[model samples]
Target: MRTRFTWGLTVNIMPPDYELRLKIVKNKIAGHEVSKLIAPEVLEYIANNCENDVRHLEGAINRLYAVTAMYSPKEINLEFAKDALKDYIGSSVYITNNIQKIQKAVAEYYDLTVESLKSKKRTAIINHARQVAIYLCKMTTEETLDKIGLEFNRDHATVIHACDKIGESLKKDEELREEINKIKDKIMN
Candidate 1:
Protein backbone atom coordinates (compact mmCIF):
# COMPACT_ATOMS: atom_id res chain seq x y z
CA MET A 1 0.00 0.00 0.00
CA ARG A 2 2.34 2.76 -1.20
CA THR A 3 1.06 6.25 -0.37
CA ARG A 4 0.93 9.49 -2.43
CA PHE A 5 4.59 9.78 -3.50
CA THR A 6 3.89 8.93 -7.12
CA TRP A 7 5.90 10.64 -9.89
CA GLY A 8 3.92 13.66 -11.06
CA LEU A 9 5.81 14.70 -14.20
CA THR A 10 8.95 12.93 -15.28
CA VAL A 11 11.79 15.31 -16.03
CA ASN A 12 14.67 14.02 -18.17
CA ILE A 13 18.11 15.40 -17.41
CA MET A 14 19.99 16.09 -20.58
CA PRO A 15 23.58 17.04 -21.30
CA PRO A 16 24.32 20.70 -20.87
CA ASP A 17 23.62 22.91 -23.86
CA TYR A 18 26.24 25.11 -25.42
CA GLU A 19 25.72 28.12 -23.19
CA LEU A 20 25.76 25.96 -20.10
CA ARG A 21 28.91 24.20 -21.22
CA LEU A 22 30.59 27.55 -21.72
CA LYS A 23 29.41 28.69 -18.33
CA ILE A 24 30.67 25.49 -16.78
CA VAL A 25 34.08 25.92 -18.30
CA LYS A 26 34.16 29.54 -17.18
CA ASN A 27 33.18 28.66 -13.67
CA LYS A 28 35.87 26.01 -13.58
CA ILE A 29 38.43 28.53 -14.75
CA ALA A 30 37.35 30.92 -12.02
CA GLY A 31 37.41 28.15 -9.48
CA HIS A 32 40.95 27.35 -10.50
CA GLU A 33 41.79 31.06 -10.18
CA VAL A 34 43.01 31.02 -13.77
CA SER A 35 40.38 33.19 -15.35
CA LYS A 36 43.01 35.84 -15.84
CA LEU A 37 45.33 33.35 -17.47
CA ILE A 38 43.01 32.02 -20.17
CA ALA A 39 42.10 34.08 -23.20
CA PRO A 40 38.47 34.84 -24.04
CA GLU A 41 38.99 33.41 -27.51
CA VAL A 42 40.14 30.12 -25.99
CA LEU A 43 37.01 29.94 -23.88
CA GLU A 44 34.91 29.85 -27.02
CA TYR A 45 37.31 27.44 -28.61
CA ILE A 46 36.94 25.11 -25.66
CA ALA A 47 33.20 25.36 -25.81
CA ASN A 48 33.11 24.57 -29.50
CA ASN A 49 35.73 21.88 -29.68
CA CYS A 50 35.56 19.93 -26.44
CA GLU A 51 33.83 16.56 -26.31
CA ASN A 52 30.36 16.07 -24.85
CA ASP A 53 31.75 15.56 -21.37
CA VAL A 54 31.59 18.95 -19.72
CA ARG A 55 34.15 17.92 -17.07
CA HIS A 56 36.59 17.75 -19.91
CA LEU A 57 36.36 21.52 -20.15
CA GLU A 58 37.90 22.03 -16.73
CA GLY A 59 40.58 19.45 -17.47
CA ALA A 60 41.28 21.14 -20.78
CA ILE A 61 41.66 24.54 -19.18
CA ASN A 62 43.95 23.11 -16.51
CA ARG A 63 46.05 21.30 -19.08
CA LEU A 64 46.20 24.40 -21.21
CA TYR A 65 47.42 26.42 -18.28
CA ALA A 66 50.14 23.89 -17.48
CA VAL A 67 51.39 23.73 -21.06
CA THR A 68 51.48 27.49 -21.47
CA ALA A 69 53.25 27.86 -18.19
CA MET A 70 56.24 25.94 -19.52
CA TYR A 71 56.47 28.19 -22.58
CA SER A 72 55.60 31.32 -20.58
CA PRO A 73 53.66 32.88 -23.44
CA LYS A 74 52.17 36.32 -22.87
CA GLU A 75 48.84 35.94 -24.62
CA ILE A 76 47.21 32.56 -25.22
CA ASN A 77 45.48 32.64 -28.59
CA LEU A 78 43.65 30.24 -30.91
CA GLU A 79 46.74 28.97 -32.67
CA PHE A 80 48.48 28.33 -29.39
CA ALA A 81 45.37 26.69 -28.03
CA LYS A 82 45.12 24.43 -31.04
CA ASP A 83 48.74 23.43 -30.65
CA ALA A 84 48.78 23.07 -26.89
CA LEU A 85 45.63 20.99 -26.80
CA LYS A 86 46.55 18.87 -29.77
CA ASP A 87 45.64 15.76 -27.83
CA TYR A 88 42.14 17.08 -27.56
CA ILE A 89 42.24 18.89 -30.92
CA GLY A 90 43.85 16.00 -32.85
CA SER A 91 47.29 15.69 -34.47
CA SER A 92 46.96 18.61 -36.83
CA VAL A 93 50.09 20.59 -37.50
CA TYR A 94 48.73 24.04 -36.90
CA ILE A 95 52.28 25.17 -36.28
CA THR A 96 54.02 22.89 -38.73
CA ASN A 97 56.68 25.22 -40.02
CA ASN A 98 59.77 25.35 -37.84
CA ILE A 99 60.15 29.06 -38.66
CA GLN A 100 56.58 29.67 -37.54
CA LYS A 101 57.20 27.91 -34.25
CA ILE A 102 60.30 30.02 -33.59
CA GLN A 103 58.46 33.20 -34.48
CA LYS A 104 55.57 32.22 -32.27
CA ALA A 105 57.86 31.49 -29.31
CA VAL A 106 59.80 34.71 -29.78
CA ALA A 107 56.67 36.78 -30.27
CA GLU A 108 54.94 35.30 -27.28
CA TYR A 109 58.05 35.76 -25.17
CA TYR A 110 58.30 39.43 -26.17
CA ASP A 111 54.54 39.97 -26.34
CA LEU A 112 54.76 40.97 -30.01
CA THR A 113 53.16 39.73 -33.19
CA VAL A 114 54.83 37.59 -35.87
CA GLU A 115 53.57 40.13 -38.40
CA SER A 116 55.17 42.98 -36.48
CA LEU A 117 58.39 41.02 -36.29
CA LYS A 118 58.17 40.56 -40.06
CA SER A 119 57.25 44.17 -40.71
CA LYS A 120 59.61 47.12 -41.16
CA LYS A 121 59.01 48.35 -37.66
CA ARG A 122 62.26 49.85 -36.44
CA THR A 123 61.27 50.61 -32.89
CA ALA A 124 63.85 49.53 -30.33
CA ILE A 125 61.72 46.78 -28.84
CA ILE A 126 60.41 45.39 -32.10
CA ASN A 127 63.84 45.45 -33.67
CA HIS A 128 65.44 43.60 -30.78
CA ALA A 129 62.73 40.98 -30.72
CA ARG A 130 62.97 40.54 -34.48
CA GLN A 131 66.69 40.05 -34.27
CA VAL A 132 66.28 37.50 -31.54
CA ALA A 133 63.71 35.59 -33.57
CA ILE A 134 65.93 35.67 -36.64
CA TYR A 135 68.87 34.42 -34.65
CA LEU A 136 66.87 31.55 -33.20
CA CYS A 137 65.58 30.51 -36.60
CA LYS A 138 69.07 30.50 -38.02
CA MET A 139 70.57 28.64 -35.09
CA THR A 140 67.85 26.03 -34.78
CA THR A 141 67.13 25.15 -38.40
CA GLU A 142 69.11 24.46 -41.55
CA GLU A 143 67.02 27.07 -43.39
CA THR A 144 69.21 29.55 -45.19
CA LEU A 145 69.20 33.25 -44.40
CA ASP A 146 67.42 33.83 -47.70
CA LYS A 147 64.57 31.54 -46.68
CA ILE A 148 64.33 32.87 -43.14
CA GLY A 149 64.42 36.41 -44.45
CA LEU A 150 61.56 35.61 -46.80
CA GLU A 151 59.49 34.43 -43.88
CA PHE A 152 60.11 37.75 -42.14
CA ASN A 153 59.44 39.76 -45.32
CA ARG A 154 63.05 40.78 -45.69
CA ASP A 155 66.03 39.74 -47.74
CA HIS A 156 69.09 37.76 -46.82
CA ALA A 157 70.90 40.95 -45.81
CA THR A 158 68.39 41.65 -43.04
CA VAL A 159 68.69 38.09 -41.77
CA ILE A 160 72.47 38.34 -41.82
CA HIS A 161 72.41 41.61 -39.90
CA ALA A 162 70.00 40.27 -37.32
CA CYS A 163 72.16 37.23 -36.79
CA ASP A 164 75.34 39.30 -36.43
CA LYS A 165 73.73 41.89 -34.18
CA ILE A 166 72.03 39.47 -31.85
CA GLY A 167 75.01 37.17 -31.93
CA GLU A 168 77.34 39.99 -30.90
CA SER A 169 74.97 41.27 -28.29
CA LEU A 170 74.68 37.84 -26.66
CA LYS A 171 78.41 37.86 -25.95
CA LYS A 172 78.17 40.72 -23.46
CA ASP A 173 74.48 41.12 -22.60
CA GLU A 174 73.64 38.55 -19.95
CA GLU A 175 70.04 39.67 -19.93
CA LEU A 176 69.77 39.11 -23.63
CA ARG A 177 71.38 35.73 -23.26
CA GLU A 178 68.78 34.80 -20.68
CA GLU A 179 65.97 36.12 -22.83
CA ILE A 180 67.21 34.17 -25.78
CA ASN A 181 67.47 31.06 -23.68
CA LYS A 182 63.91 31.55 -22.47
CA ILE A 183 62.68 31.98 -26.01
CA LYS A 184 64.56 28.89 -27.04
CA ASP A 185 63.09 27.01 -24.15
CA LYS A 186 59.64 27.90 -25.35
CA ILE A 187 60.48 26.85 -28.83
CA MET A 188 61.94 23.48 -27.89
CA ASN A 189 59.47 22.41 -25.23
Candidate 2:
Protein backbone atom coordinates (compact mmCIF):
# COMPACT_ATOMS: atom_id res chain seq x y z
CA MET A 1 0.00 0.00 0.00
CA ARG A 2 1.25 3.44 -0.86
CA THR A 3 1.13 6.17 1.73
CA ARG A 4 -1.26 8.98 0.80
CA PHE A 5 -1.46 12.48 2.23
CA THR A 6 -3.83 15.26 1.40
CA TRP A 7 -3.46 18.82 2.60
CA GLY A 8 -6.38 21.23 2.81
CA LEU A 9 -5.74 24.89 3.52
CA THR A 10 -7.42 27.85 1.92
CA VAL A 11 -6.62 31.47 2.53
CA ASN A 12 -8.83 34.29 1.32
CA ILE A 13 -7.26 37.73 1.53
CA MET A 14 -9.82 40.47 1.13
CA PRO A 15 -9.47 44.22 1.59
CA PRO A 16 -9.99 45.29 5.16
CA ASP A 17 -13.51 46.54 5.86
CA TYR A 18 -14.50 50.10 6.77
CA GLU A 19 -13.96 50.01 10.53
CA LEU A 20 -10.80 47.96 10.25
CA ARG A 21 -9.48 50.30 7.64
CA LEU A 22 -10.22 53.22 9.93
CA LYS A 23 -8.34 51.49 12.72
CA ILE A 24 -5.39 50.89 10.43
CA VAL A 25 -5.39 54.54 9.50
CA LYS A 26 -5.57 55.60 13.12
CA ASN A 27 -2.76 53.25 14.08
CA LYS A 28 -0.52 54.67 11.39
CA ILE A 29 -1.36 58.20 12.43
CA ALA A 30 -0.70 57.43 16.08
CA GLY A 31 2.51 55.62 15.27
CA HIS A 32 3.82 58.60 13.34
CA GLU A 33 2.12 61.30 15.46
CA VAL A 34 0.58 62.57 12.22
CA SER A 35 -2.46 63.74 14.16
CA LYS A 36 -0.47 66.83 15.18
CA LEU A 37 0.13 67.72 11.53
CA ILE A 38 -3.20 66.72 9.94
CA ALA A 39 -6.84 66.67 10.92
CA PRO A 40 -8.72 63.41 11.61
CA GLU A 41 -11.10 64.20 8.76
CA VAL A 42 -8.22 64.38 6.32
CA LEU A 43 -6.89 61.03 7.51
CA GLU A 44 -10.39 59.57 7.25
CA TYR A 45 -10.66 60.85 3.71
CA ILE A 46 -7.44 59.11 2.78
CA ALA A 47 -8.57 55.89 4.45
CA ASN A 48 -11.92 55.83 2.68
CA ASN A 49 -10.60 56.79 -0.72
CA CYS A 50 -7.63 54.45 -0.56
CA GLU A 51 -9.80 51.42 0.33
CA ASN A 52 -8.63 49.19 -2.52
CA ASP A 53 -5.62 47.73 -0.69
CA VAL A 54 -3.59 48.14 2.46
CA ARG A 55 -0.52 48.94 0.41
CA HIS A 56 -2.42 51.72 -1.37
CA LEU A 57 -3.62 53.07 1.98
CA GLU A 58 -0.07 53.06 3.30
CA GLY A 59 1.19 54.79 0.19
CA ALA A 60 -1.48 57.44 0.51
CA ILE A 61 -0.46 58.01 4.11
CA ASN A 62 3.19 58.32 3.14
CA ARG A 63 2.32 60.68 0.30
CA LEU A 64 0.26 62.81 2.65
CA TYR A 65 3.13 62.97 5.13
CA ALA A 66 5.60 63.89 2.39
CA VAL A 67 3.38 66.65 1.02
CA THR A 68 2.68 68.04 4.48
CA ALA A 69 6.35 67.93 5.34
CA MET A 70 7.22 69.86 2.18
CA TYR A 71 4.70 72.59 2.98
CA SER A 72 5.26 72.51 6.75
CA PRO A 73 1.59 73.09 7.26
CA LYS A 74 0.06 73.98 10.62
CA GLU A 75 -2.79 71.65 9.72
CA ILE A 76 -3.80 69.45 6.75
CA ASN A 77 -7.47 69.51 5.90
CA LEU A 78 -9.89 67.96 3.38
CA GLU A 79 -8.90 70.44 0.66
CA PHE A 80 -5.27 69.55 1.17
CA ALA A 81 -6.08 65.81 0.98
CA LYS A 82 -7.99 66.33 -2.26
CA ASP A 83 -5.18 68.33 -3.83
CA ALA A 84 -2.53 65.81 -2.78
CA LEU A 85 -4.43 62.68 -3.84
CA LYS A 86 -6.11 63.98 -6.97
CA ASP A 87 -4.18 61.73 -9.33
CA TYR A 88 -4.40 58.67 -7.11
CA ILE A 89 -8.18 58.91 -6.72
CA GLY A 90 -8.82 59.86 -10.33
CA SER A 91 -6.81 56.92 -11.72
CA SER A 92 -8.99 54.33 -9.92
CA VAL A 93 -11.83 55.03 -12.34
CA TYR A 94 -9.53 54.71 -15.36
CA ILE A 95 -8.42 51.29 -14.17
CA THR A 96 -11.87 49.81 -14.86
CA ASN A 97 -12.75 51.66 -18.09
CA ASN A 98 -9.94 50.74 -20.46
CA ILE A 99 -9.22 49.32 -23.92
CA GLN A 100 -8.73 45.72 -22.75
CA LYS A 101 -12.22 45.77 -21.22
CA ILE A 102 -13.76 47.00 -24.49
CA GLN A 103 -11.75 44.47 -26.51
CA LYS A 104 -12.76 41.56 -24.31
CA ALA A 105 -16.43 42.52 -24.38
CA VAL A 106 -16.41 42.97 -28.15
CA ALA A 107 -14.50 39.73 -28.78
CA GLU A 108 -16.87 37.76 -26.55
CA TYR A 109 -19.91 39.24 -28.26
CA TYR A 110 -18.60 38.31 -31.73
CA ASP A 111 -17.45 34.86 -30.57
CA LEU A 112 -13.88 35.78 -31.54
CA THR A 113 -10.60 36.09 -29.69
CA VAL A 114 -9.19 39.51 -28.76
CA GLU A 115 -6.15 38.58 -30.83
CA SER A 116 -8.39 38.16 -33.91
CA LEU A 117 -9.70 41.70 -33.53
CA LYS A 118 -6.13 43.04 -33.09
CA SER A 119 -4.72 41.22 -36.11
CA LYS A 120 -4.12 42.79 -39.57
CA LYS A 121 -6.71 40.56 -41.25
CA ARG A 122 -8.86 42.18 -43.96
CA THR A 123 -11.67 39.64 -43.91
CA ALA A 124 -15.10 41.22 -43.57
CA ILE A 125 -15.94 39.61 -40.21
CA ILE A 126 -12.62 40.41 -38.58
CA ASN A 127 -12.58 43.98 -39.94
CA HIS A 128 -16.13 44.63 -38.72
CA ALA A 129 -15.27 43.25 -35.28
CA ARG A 130 -12.16 45.41 -35.07
CA GLN A 131 -14.13 48.48 -36.09
CA VAL A 132 -16.75 47.80 -33.44
CA ALA A 133 -14.01 47.43 -30.81
CA ILE A 134 -12.55 50.76 -31.85
CA TYR A 135 -15.96 52.44 -31.70
CA LEU A 136 -16.63 51.08 -28.22
CA CYS A 137 -13.20 52.17 -27.03
CA LYS A 138 -13.95 55.68 -28.20
CA MET A 139 -17.38 55.67 -26.57
CA THR A 140 -16.42 54.30 -23.17
CA THR A 141 -12.92 55.57 -22.41
CA GLU A 142 -11.11 58.90 -22.10
CA GLU A 143 -8.03 57.40 -23.74
CA THR A 144 -6.68 59.35 -26.68
CA LEU A 145 -6.86 58.10 -30.29
CA ASP A 146 -3.14 57.37 -30.12
CA LYS A 147 -3.63 55.22 -27.04
CA ILE A 148 -6.51 53.30 -28.63
CA GLY A 149 -4.48 52.81 -31.80
CA LEU A 150 -1.55 51.50 -29.79
CA GLU A 151 -3.81 48.84 -28.29
CA PHE A 152 -4.63 47.51 -31.78
CA ASN A 153 -1.13 48.04 -33.21
CA ARG A 154 -2.55 50.66 -35.62
CA ASP A 155 -2.13 54.38 -36.14
CA HIS A 156 -4.38 57.10 -34.76
CA ALA A 157 -5.79 57.74 -38.27
CA THR A 158 -6.73 54.06 -38.55
CA VAL A 159 -8.53 54.27 -35.21
CA ILE A 160 -10.36 57.41 -36.35
CA HIS A 161 -11.34 55.75 -39.67
CA ALA A 162 -12.66 52.68 -37.86
CA CYS A 163 -14.84 54.81 -35.57
CA ASP A 164 -16.20 56.85 -38.44
CA LYS A 165 -16.90 53.75 -40.53
CA ILE A 166 -18.71 52.07 -37.67
CA GLY A 167 -20.70 55.24 -36.95
CA GLU A 168 -21.88 55.34 -40.57
CA SER A 169 -22.67 51.62 -40.67
CA LEU A 170 -24.73 51.87 -37.48
CA LYS A 171 -26.88 54.55 -39.09
CA LYS A 172 -27.91 52.33 -42.03
CA ASP A 173 -27.84 48.75 -40.66
CA GLU A 174 -30.48 47.93 -38.07
CA GLU A 175 -29.07 44.48 -37.29
CA LEU A 176 -25.58 45.88 -36.83
CA ARG A 177 -26.99 48.67 -34.63
CA GLU A 178 -28.75 46.15 -32.42
CA GLU A 179 -25.58 44.02 -32.18
CA ILE A 180 -23.49 46.99 -31.14
CA ASN A 181 -26.11 48.05 -28.61
CA LYS A 182 -26.03 44.62 -26.99
CA ILE A 183 -22.22 44.76 -26.75
CA LYS A 184 -22.38 48.26 -25.30
CA ASP A 185 -24.97 47.18 -22.75
CA LYS A 186 -22.70 44.34 -21.67
CA ILE A 187 -19.79 46.69 -21.19
CA MET A 188 -21.75 49.43 -19.45
CA ASN A 189 -23.48 47.08 -17.04
Candidate 3:
Protein backbone atom coordinates (compact mmCIF):
# COMPACT_ATOMS: atom_id res chain seq x y z
CA MET A 1 0.00 0.00 0.00
CA ARG A 2 1.21 3.50 -0.86
CA THR A 3 0.13 6.67 0.88
CA ARG A 4 0.85 10.25 -0.14
CA PHE A 5 1.40 12.79 2.60
CA THR A 6 1.92 16.54 2.74
CA TRP A 7 4.01 18.21 5.43
CA GLY A 8 2.45 21.02 7.41
CA LEU A 9 4.22 24.27 8.24
CA THR A 10 6.36 24.11 11.36
CA VAL A 11 6.18 26.70 14.09
CA ASN A 12 9.39 27.48 15.98
CA ILE A 13 8.76 28.42 19.59
CA MET A 14 11.64 30.67 20.49
CA PRO A 15 12.44 31.08 24.16
CA PRO A 16 10.62 33.91 25.89
CA ASP A 17 12.38 37.10 26.96
CA TYR A 18 12.70 38.23 30.59
CA GLU A 19 9.27 39.81 31.04
CA LEU A 20 7.57 37.06 29.07
CA ARG A 21 9.43 34.38 31.03
CA LEU A 22 8.16 35.92 34.25
CA LYS A 23 4.63 35.90 32.91
CA ILE A 24 4.95 32.27 31.86
CA VAL A 25 6.11 31.22 35.33
CA LYS A 26 3.35 33.18 37.00
CA ASN A 27 0.79 31.66 34.67
CA LYS A 28 2.09 28.12 35.25
CA ILE A 29 1.94 28.54 39.02
CA ALA A 30 -1.54 29.96 38.78
CA GLY A 31 -2.60 27.09 36.55
CA HIS A 32 -1.42 24.71 39.25
CA GLU A 33 -3.76 26.46 41.70
CA VAL A 34 -0.78 27.66 43.74
CA SER A 35 -1.89 30.87 45.39
CA LYS A 36 1.49 31.83 46.81
CA LEU A 37 2.73 35.19 45.60
CA ILE A 38 6.07 34.88 43.84
CA ALA A 39 8.23 37.92 44.51
CA PRO A 40 9.08 40.01 41.45
CA GLU A 41 12.76 39.53 42.17
CA VAL A 42 12.28 35.77 42.27
CA LEU A 43 10.62 35.80 38.85
CA GLU A 44 13.37 38.00 37.51
CA TYR A 45 16.01 35.68 38.86
CA ILE A 46 14.45 32.65 37.19
CA ALA A 47 13.95 34.59 33.99
CA ASN A 48 17.56 35.58 33.84
CA ASN A 49 18.90 32.10 34.55
CA CYS A 50 16.47 30.16 32.38
CA GLU A 51 16.09 32.56 29.44
CA ASN A 52 17.42 30.41 26.62
CA ASP A 53 14.77 27.72 26.93
CA VAL A 54 11.11 27.74 27.82
CA ARG A 55 11.47 24.18 29.12
CA HIS A 56 14.16 25.35 31.51
CA LEU A 57 11.89 28.10 32.73
CA GLU A 58 9.07 25.63 33.30
CA GLY A 59 11.44 23.20 34.96
CA ALA A 60 12.51 25.90 37.34
CA ILE A 61 8.92 26.51 38.26
CA ASN A 62 8.35 22.80 38.73
CA ARG A 63 11.42 22.57 40.93
CA LEU A 64 10.18 25.42 43.06
CA TYR A 65 6.74 23.92 43.36
CA ALA A 66 8.04 20.46 44.15
CA VAL A 67 10.36 21.76 46.86
CA THR A 68 7.82 24.04 48.48
CA ALA A 69 4.58 22.18 47.88
CA MET A 70 4.05 21.36 51.53
CA TYR A 71 4.19 25.02 52.48
CA SER A 72 1.46 26.23 50.21
CA PRO A 73 0.64 29.95 50.23
CA LYS A 74 4.21 30.71 51.38
CA GLU A 75 5.65 33.54 49.30
CA ILE A 76 8.48 32.45 46.98
CA ASN A 77 11.23 35.01 47.45
CA LEU A 78 14.73 35.51 46.09
CA GLU A 79 16.37 33.13 48.54
CA PHE A 80 13.75 30.52 47.84
CA ALA A 81 14.33 30.82 44.09
CA LYS A 82 18.09 30.57 44.57
CA ASP A 83 17.74 27.48 46.70
CA ALA A 84 15.29 25.86 44.32
CA LEU A 85 17.55 26.18 41.28
CA LYS A 86 20.92 25.93 42.94
CA ASP A 87 22.42 23.73 40.23
CA TYR A 88 21.46 26.18 37.47
CA ILE A 89 22.73 29.25 39.35
CA GLY A 90 26.00 30.67 38.11
CA SER A 91 27.38 31.17 41.59
CA SER A 92 26.87 27.50 42.45
CA VAL A 93 29.71 25.06 41.82
CA TYR A 94 28.27 22.54 39.38
CA ILE A 95 31.39 20.46 38.89
CA THR A 96 32.19 18.83 42.19
CA ASN A 97 35.79 17.66 42.04
CA ASN A 98 36.93 14.31 43.30
CA ILE A 99 40.54 13.17 43.75
CA GLN A 100 40.06 10.16 41.49
CA LYS A 101 38.43 12.30 38.79
CA ILE A 102 41.32 14.73 38.96
CA GLN A 103 43.89 11.95 38.94
CA LYS A 104 42.33 10.24 35.96
CA ALA A 105 42.10 13.43 33.90
CA VAL A 106 45.68 14.49 34.67
CA ALA A 107 47.07 11.02 34.09
CA GLU A 108 45.29 10.76 30.76
CA TYR A 109 46.65 14.15 29.72
CA TYR A 110 50.19 13.12 30.68
CA ASP A 111 49.83 9.63 29.13
CA LEU A 112 50.71 8.00 32.44
CA THR A 113 48.89 5.34 34.38
CA VAL A 114 47.01 6.54 37.44
CA GLU A 115 48.98 4.04 39.49
CA SER A 116 52.24 5.49 38.15
CA LEU A 117 51.00 9.02 38.80
CA LYS A 118 50.14 8.15 42.41
CA SER A 119 53.29 6.11 43.08
CA LYS A 120 56.50 7.06 44.93
CA LYS A 121 58.65 7.34 41.79
CA ARG A 122 60.03 10.86 41.46
CA THR A 123 61.01 10.96 37.80
CA ALA A 124 60.91 14.49 36.37
CA ILE A 125 57.97 13.59 34.13
CA ILE A 126 55.89 11.86 36.78
CA ASN A 127 56.77 14.45 39.39
CA HIS A 128 55.67 17.28 37.12
CA ALA A 129 52.43 15.51 36.28
CA ARG A 130 51.82 14.76 39.95
CA GLN A 131 52.35 18.37 40.95
CA VAL A 132 49.93 19.51 38.25
CA ALA A 133 47.38 17.01 39.49
CA ILE A 134 47.79 18.16 43.07
CA TYR A 135 47.37 21.79 42.11
CA LEU A 136 44.23 21.01 40.10
CA CYS A 137 42.75 19.07 43.00
CA LYS A 138 43.27 22.05 45.24
CA MET A 139 41.75 24.45 42.76
CA THR A 140 38.74 22.40 41.64
CA THR A 141 37.78 20.47 44.75
CA GLU A 142 36.52 21.31 48.19
CA GLU A 143 38.67 18.53 49.64
CA THR A 144 40.63 19.44 52.71
CA LEU A 145 44.38 20.03 52.35
CA ASP A 146 45.03 16.87 54.33
CA LYS A 147 42.54 14.87 52.26
CA ILE A 148 44.12 15.83 48.95
CA GLY A 149 47.52 15.12 50.42
CA LEU A 150 46.35 11.67 51.47
CA GLU A 151 45.10 10.93 47.94
CA PHE A 152 48.49 11.86 46.47
CA ASN A 153 50.41 10.11 49.29
CA ARG A 154 52.02 13.41 50.24
CA ASP A 155 51.93 15.51 53.36
CA HIS A 156 49.65 18.55 53.54
CA ALA A 157 52.74 20.75 53.53
CA THR A 158 53.88 19.14 50.28
CA VAL A 159 50.49 19.79 48.71
CA ILE A 160 50.67 23.39 49.93
CA HIS A 161 54.16 23.77 48.46
CA ALA A 162 53.07 22.33 45.11
CA CYS A 163 50.09 24.71 45.00
CA ASP A 164 52.38 27.65 45.75
CA LYS A 165 54.86 26.54 43.12
CA ILE A 166 52.15 26.14 40.51
CA GLY A 167 50.60 29.45 41.44
CA GLU A 168 53.94 31.24 41.04
CA SER A 169 54.71 29.35 37.83
CA LEU A 170 51.38 30.48 36.46
CA LYS A 171 52.33 34.05 37.16
CA LYS A 172 55.57 33.98 35.09
CA ASP A 173 55.44 30.96 32.74
CA GLU A 174 52.90 31.94 30.05
CA GLU A 175 53.00 28.67 28.11
CA LEU A 176 52.80 26.57 31.26
CA ARG A 177 49.96 28.75 32.49
CA GLU A 178 48.02 28.16 29.28
CA GLU A 179 48.65 24.43 29.42
CA ILE A 180 47.44 24.29 33.00
CA ASN A 181 44.38 26.34 32.19
CA LYS A 182 43.59 23.95 29.34
CA ILE A 183 43.87 21.03 31.73
CA LYS A 184 41.59 22.78 34.21
CA ASP A 185 39.07 23.48 31.46
CA LYS A 186 39.14 19.83 30.50
CA ILE A 187 38.50 18.88 34.10
CA MET A 188 35.62 21.29 34.63
CA ASN A 189 34.03 21.13 31.19
Stretches of candidate 2 off by over 4 Å are 1-96
Model 1 residue pairs with clashes: none
Score each candidate by Cα lDDT: 0.72, 0.74, 0.70
Residue-wise lDDT of candidate 3 within 1-189, one digit each (tens)?
223333555587766644566678667777565535676556645654565677888887888777777666467765666666676554423226689988988898888999988799999989889998887776555567799899989998989788777655654676765566566657666
User: Which regions of candidate 3 deviate over 4 angstroms?
Assistant: 1-95
Which one wins on lDDT? 2
Ranking by lDDT: 2, 1, 3
Superposition error at 40 for model 2 (Å):
48
How big is the positional error of residue 65 in model 1, measured in Å on the Cα after superposition?
45
TM-score of 3: 0.51
TM, every model: 0.49, 0.49, 0.51
| Candidate 1 stretches greater than 4 Å from native | 1-97
Name the 10 consecutive residues with the lowest summed lDDT in model 1. Answer: 88-97
Error of 2 at 20 (Å): 49
Alpha-carbon lDDT of model 2: 0.74
